[model samples]
Target: MATKSLKAKGNELAESNKQLDILNGGIFAEGELPFFKDKINEIGHFPLRPKKLEILQINVGYMCNQVCEHCHVDAGPDRKEIMTRETMAQCIEIIRNTGAHTLDLTGGAPEMNPDFRWFVEEAAKAGIKDFIVRSNLTIIRANKKYYDLPDFFKKHNVHVISSMPHYTRGKTDKQRGDGVFDKSIKALQELNARGYGMPDSSLRLDLVYNPSGAYLPGDQMALEADFKKALKEDFDIQFHNLFAITNLPIARFLDYLIASENYEDYMYSLVEAYNPAAVENVMCTNTISISWDGWIYDCDFNQMLDLKVASKVKHIKDYNEDLLNDRNIIISQHCYGCTAGAGSSCQGTVA
Candidate 1:
């Protein structure tokens, strides 16, 4: 992924009014933290831009059953940013015409969306190479209506990427909620029963591991190995892979850092662990994030920050892949969260 070196100019990237407001406030401006753009600039990657646009990650809504403390979207039951079928219709059009190979559906719990199944059924017809549904796991056990989610996912050949904060109950429940571990375990077992994570099965079941506190994740392969061994040993659970995602400081997570007085320390860690190599394959370079309403962003974090795409095509209704791809990727202090250490992405470490 060779990149064109951006000219060092004030108008390069951080000049966007909204991005400046976001980056200049908070600890980034108050403290002497290294700006993420400056770090990337050291490697001549200023004014980051998109590449092939491989993934279209859509946040169906923020109506989640469980309110994880580290949720960047601040998603919860009381939130009312649910996507209507009208916007979904616009998304369906993009799904059919997108050059992106992966169509990722995320939410508080995507299944909670009233028309979730209809959307999935329609999306499946597009024959996308990879259709990802980021489930909270417990949603399968949240209610009887969601009981058939595993079978529903299997029918659409949807890739199941569920979050399992940890293999242990204490850690998992602490980050999520009480009884979450039991329900998630049951959901995983149900998925396994349907051959979702069986070795060599086309049905893929992967678990995402987010550190329960204010810290970065360790080695991906090491974590995956540990999670696999523990889950299999304890409950005979089988999963294909584990994604160790670093918790970015934003939204509920930012609130946690501030409340715990770990904001500055966490920012320092992110800056210290910065990896320029990871910038080459940062998810933002190849993916576009569409919010619940239809606003597009460089990535989901950017969406949460209300940083719309720095392009003419800023919404799904007016999505123009060519024009969108031509725009510079938005950058700010939070970007360091994605570039720290091995580099975190929705698919785990990029480096």
Candidate 2:
């Protein structure tokens, strides 16, 4: 794992505005690729607006155990930002009444938050149909205190969506960190022992496979098949599904693209694979992303870029879904990532 986040290293890319400048100033400024708004406008979809809310994707903190090279959150042990119980209380209040059906909890590793369990236990009571906890897997083995995480999740029926990167140890460890593969395998087994990912269980245990590098993921079903075969044969591990997500160019990923001189080519790839149908179901249209400090955004990507919602309601403390639903979704070059190919969202492909 990287010893420090770009923010801790004082890398300019840590600044959302700096990253936005690069995203907005590059080949985009020279018309090498159409600006995201123009691309959307070609289909009469400019000024992207929200639809009926369906998911509440909340970032409880940025503190995480690993520093994956492609991490858009730039989360790591070095990150100190965390959500306080007070902010979480506000979230629970909204959760108890929101019309949204899915409640997604994310972070550097949301488990790192001091009040993570308290928040989960409270939110679970809201009776949301799909309760998700985006776990990093290794965190379940990082410390003894976390050993019971699988049991806790099973008790609450929290849908465990873990980041596996690849089915092979080499690719998995390379993208996340050394020893991550072994630990993740163990964690998956433990989750299995608790009935997660088991074919006969209702406990949903899904693995997320984002490309280890600057490339779009292949077919989700094919990748899921390969992962199932490799994992079941190699480790007797089982997961219900695999979500193949496109790596949006932002945060550490954008840094990698720029440092490796693949930014332009990657942008070209995204533009070439742009699927107009994908734009209609982008996460921004149905989800509201809340930051660690309670600020609201159109989506997690926009949250990282510090793009607050274009509405009167701007924070969780002041959440007004009706007003929030009536706003334009922000767009920029990075928007291409979510609209490319089959289209990527938190729930995997849309088209």
Candidate 3:
């Protein structure tokens, strides 16, 4: 009976996805992050100071199995863009020269890239202190080739950060497509078996949560407890940590806001909750995002909006730490998502 229900739900989702593709014209469109806009206007123009670049996040490709409703990357299986070996080589050279402590790999599914493992293996050889793979979870179980990713990550001691939109199947499926929740859970259990979430285990597996609707996420610590309890009770899964991320208003999510008529209300919420302290620790101050094509941006959200870094060095081949640090962060309404409440960043709450 459960199997039948799951199959029926999957079929329904397939039909919904087809309709979404039509509504989006096969390409995700931009929507408003009202709060970001209001904050930008109120704060006026302030120059961003470059602290030492500690983490370099590289986008390997835009190919993904599922097109979620709130995706900021607007990535899908149809996306043909993938990073070339030449660009990867350039990034490696930058890593060698820059002495950045961490390398964060992200994508529609970073594992989908042919060079994904190669990049990880090579980067591991570089002796970087931390390696992180931002996975969508479902990809680990979606293909035979990727099934061994947990072991691969274990071999490299890679810190795995994966998305699981909600603890409940209903909400998670609604946001990420049907069967995603089940696959994600199975993948998590596999990671746990390899000592990912266990105490004293070197393998770290963290789950990422973003609200399915237009509202901001509740308290991070509190939400983590709920997730930990739910996943443990229902699926016998364990993870090292839970990161609550606010969905930035850009890309597919922005399109949802415009389509659902929630754009103004969502923006107002962000602006109203703005805390000045959040601005000081915004992730862009400490991190830089590299697109699949090798263009640099202040952060990943900025990258999707085609907002290039304000620095003279805009690409990896000619990465200039001094110039990038001296440049101002490109400001827009979308930024409010990062600065609201306790603040949110790729690594979770900034404040």
Best by TM-score: 2
Where model 2 places Cα greater than 4 Å from the true spot, the runs are none
TM-score for each of the candidates: 0.93, 0.99, 0.88
After superposing candidate 3 on the true structure, give the runs of residues whose Cα lies further than 4 Å from its correct spot: 1-45
In candidate 2, residue 161 scores what lDDT? 98
Weakest 10 consecutive residues of candidate 2 by summed lDDT? 1-10
Of 2 and 3, the candidate ahead on lDDT is 2
- Candidate 2 lDDT (Cα, whole model)? 0.93
Error in Å for residue 164 of model 3: 0.8
Where model 1 places Cα greater than 4 Å from the true spot, the runs are: 1-23
TM-score of 2: 0.99
For candidate 3, write residues 7-101 as lDDT tens digits: 12353222333333333332223433332434444664366555788889999987888778887777777676788888898888777767578
The local distance difference test score of model 1 is 0.86
C-alpha lDDT values of all predictions: 0.86, 0.93, 0.80
Candidate 2's clash total is 0
lDDT of 2 at 318: 78
Clashing pairs in 3: 31-254, 34-267, 35-267, 36-333, 37-333
lDDT of 2 at 59: 97
RMSD, candidate 2, Å: 0.7
Better of 1 and 3 by TM-score: 1
